[model samples]
Target: MAFREMFSKNHRTTDAAPPASTETGRDDTSFYDLKHKIHGRLIEETNLAALDSMDPAEIKTEVGGVVEYFLQEEQALLNEEEKRQLIVEVLNELMGLGPIEPFLKDPTISDILCNTYKDIFVERFGLLEKTSARFIDNAHLMNIIDRIISRVGRRIDESSPMVDARLPDGSRVNAIIPPLAIDGPILSIRRFAVNPLKMQDLVNYRTLTPQIAEFLAGCVKAKLNIMISGGTGAGKTTLLNILSGFIPANERIVTIEDSAELQMQQPHVVRLETRPASIEGTGTVTQRDLVRNSLRMRPDRIIIGEVRGAESFDMLQAMNTGHEGSLTTIHANTPRDSLTRLESMILMTGTNLPESAMRFMLSSALDLIIQSTRLTDGTRKVTAISEVVGMEGEVITLQDIFVFEKKGVDKDGKVLGRFMATGIRPKFADRLELAGIEVPEDLFSIDRYYE
Candidate 1:
């Protein structure tokens, strides 16, 4: 009688149970268990090594088996369509990223930055925003990273914990793991658009006004040595790509970069990318290596992605020698500072050239400096277009043809700025005239110019 009363009390308590945190915990455990099972089976039946070697279609064939197994196992627990949906979830977790596939497919997302497991962000429409996607854990994240690098025949390990790679879609990737990244693994992906931006797109986006665009087009046509300067993520490469479109399509264009990112519209273009040192610390091809080799390629125009180190000296020499109309990008804050940065970078070459000699070389090789800035509103615009008139004694003389005057921000937090002519006509106008390029006579007139 006592045992029956105890059982009856227990049954009554279960029927009147309060909200159970354990129930929520059990649900999470079940989800993880299903994911783990799918992950294990994917590794087993997929012939992990062969899967690594297979083409995308073959890999998907293996992935389909894992998906079918997952559907079969979950069918009784879920309705027909729900089981089908679960199959997608399992395949996403096993074969590739599940819910984040759409974001990866979206061409507008130029970058995907992950600060942590939960704090994912993407750059879209030239702006960064937090994304609602994540990897299950660090292991899953590492697997994806490793898969990408392996396909490119690269490696990362304790001895070399950092890697730079490009995705099949031409997105540049830099990843660093633990000892170097104390917080967690960090990945920075810079996406490249398959379609190169046309000059009109730049004008429509207000990167530069139409008048400025016309002026730059004339400069390119006239074979002016141009240096584009900007800070990190300042859209230097994009601007360089657009400027390259100004080159006559028939000219033989050669491009050198640490990684091949520029997509020029020119017909006869050759691109060279640097290679890192191999595991034995031998057989490395650097930007300087390719820059020196590019000289022998008989290039009509040579464009370096960015002159960051000793290669600046080589680039300057190329420009000074017969490589007119050459273009490149450099990291700097202002037009004047760009000259200083060039000098500093050239000094890195250990040439031991006197500072005055370096200044003279730069003043002659670089005819114009275009300074670009990413404003507080995340808009990148060319702030100044300055002319290098040649060295004034020890100093490089500069004249600003166009200046961006900040008119402050609007109610929407967007920057308001105007590009105004500084009333100084470039001395290179004579060269343009000789090239049969017509410069608007009113371009130099203050009254006739539009602000």
Candidate 2:
């Protein structure tokens, strides 16, 4: 049951969903106005400073008592059930992110997008659906946005209209307000699983087969540097997390990101997050700085959340300088594009290295590129796993070890695809053998396909 419904026993939790809104109907508008009046009075009468020190139940009880007193005094036309729900809504507005708290608790929702005060959209099971939830006004939405960014020591205002932040649970949050936003305010939340997903979960979701999972685990154990390439919302981080799980517990690992998103399960992990510049236009830390710093920390593995800027050069140096087994994700459509993006980032460092040198560095540094894609049917799948086969003349060669071949969609619009081995044993298999990790012969057999 929702927090509001649980407040009163008389209010039965029914299958019927309430108007997915704050102030659409006349009753809703009146209730909203009443809520604001009570909210203002509570802010004045209640001890706001003591709220943080008290237990959630205690705060609810204290505030609920006050709300009850005011409800009788105001003589609002509401039933007992409605009165109880009002208190819960008030608590949510005061203590939580207002209308979006319930959505945050839902595991099935992968994304929460707020275009404005009146438009709230959430992605459930990879499909976008509009919710009736809304804020009182643009100011209300901006207040919630401020609460989110301020916790992370991030500032979002006229001088800095865009800010990237995270919730307490590590969900990625981005808020862009006026001037740049054009609209009143925009908030996008990319939710993470409370319990980190395991390899079995990926297999269960058909993101990859058991064989593919085993091969990836072996690659990680073998200390082969892997790159996850995908577009936005393509499950790159999730795949990166699963791959990182294969790293042995004894090794020291360091994670660097614009925001700390990788949920590394290792005991010996050092997390470093980048910082935005202050209003004075100073005190900013970039991913390149963290990547260079992680090198001195003696990390057996350096897992970058994403290689977006000049950090790619330092990353390649780390990879070539015996810091193997590193992992990262890049926003790209295919394996070739990932290489091009990496090349471009290297050029951004003002390194006078020629094209051939860059290609050689890339071919030697990255061992594997796992391409993840969200199909038209909203199903995410590992589209291809390509191995960097070193340079052939001026060009770097790549060979696919595994690929997902798409057929046609089913009647229900479910994507039809089969994971297949390319019958080519990746050169990394030698690295696995060197590390004493066994690679099953059937794993690379073309006939051994996963339907």
Candidate 3:
């Protein structure tokens, strides 16, 4: 069966968003300042627990009363429409993170960035667009940051100037303050899907073709060790999650990540996340720690969100020792750079192993390297899928099985490219066959290309 036919049934999530506000003129500094003040008064007067249980309609009615009284007392001139906008802002502050709540709810927005109180930007459709969202001041931004981190059992203060957290919805968050941030608090959120992307969605977006997806699904079934390589925001984790969908549901997969972003749907999967150091500068758990411990858990497959540090050695150890269908992602501009980074990370363990020995070990463990790239035009594509054909001397060898050939840009500035087979049959084709998966000759035909 095709990749979509197999997995598309359970991959559904609501892609719809409630109607966005078309309200104008309220996106100014003065309006945010007044909204902040009224929110302060509402906090003092209104019962937060009661409001939390109230629906949006009830909350609107309750907030309208408090906001109207404050508007009258402060003599802030506003018409009915402006009052309604002000009420929404106040409710946002009370109910969720101020100014950013709307962007968090936006399905099209992949990232939410706060440079400072005076400036905020969001990544919409792989491009950064500045939003009119603002906090009253740096303190207000810091307060929002604190609320976010606190919910995750993490904190940010003068003693510890940086933190990594996630929202209630599992979006990745990073925040830095004064000494580290220099200007003001810097906040970044990496959003994931409420309903994760499926193979059909990737094919629809042209990230990959059905042929490539079918081949990757076969690789997963054959228990090939796969590493996804890409630069930042290149959809590495998203591909990881999609590839993970190909794993047999009966396997007890163990996933490790610093921020815990992978949404594995397998029934028997075990998810693990690293813990940051406490305020006392102790009680911290690293990815390396989890990788070492996951061994005792008898995982059928080990899925790492990414291998960036000394943990690379342990991850390689797991791959070499019966954890065959393991998957991981790494930050590199290309497939070759991923091996280089892995070698450096292994050396980080201070092991005196020779370079050739390490290369041999890496070559033996990895089966394929899939490269994901975000084009200049904000579209993401799987640029290359290379197979490790083992070492041919001191160096680990890699060959491209499939690649995306970029053919410049269109008049509308969208990227134009074709995903083509390299015509070279991978060594793992035999393994797929042995696993009862067919190896179609046309899958490796170089003459045919997908647009």
TM-score of each: 0.85, 0.92, 0.92
Tens digit of per-residue lDDT, candidate 2, span 90-128? 999899998899899899999999998989999988889
**325 Cα displacement, candidate 3 (Å):** 0.6
| lDDT per residue (tens digit) for residues 227-343 in model 3 | 999999999999999999989889999999998888888999999999988777899889999999999999999999999998999999889998899999999999999999999
Q: Considering TM-score, which of the candidate structures 1 and 2 is the better prediction for this target?
A: 2
The better-scoring model by lDDT among 1 and 3 is 3
Residue 107 displacement (Å), model 2: 1.1
Top candidate on lDDT is: 2
- Evaluated at residue 85, the lDDT of candidate 1 is 56
Collision pairs in model 1: none
Q: Answer with 2 or 3, whichever has the higher lDDT.
A: 2
| Candidate 1 Cα misplacement greater than 4 A, ranges | 1-36, 46-100, 447-451
Residue 248 lDDT, candidate 1, scale 0-100: 94
lDDT, model 2: 0.88
- Candidate 1 achieves a global lDDT of 0.77
- lDDT rank, highest first? 2, 3, 1
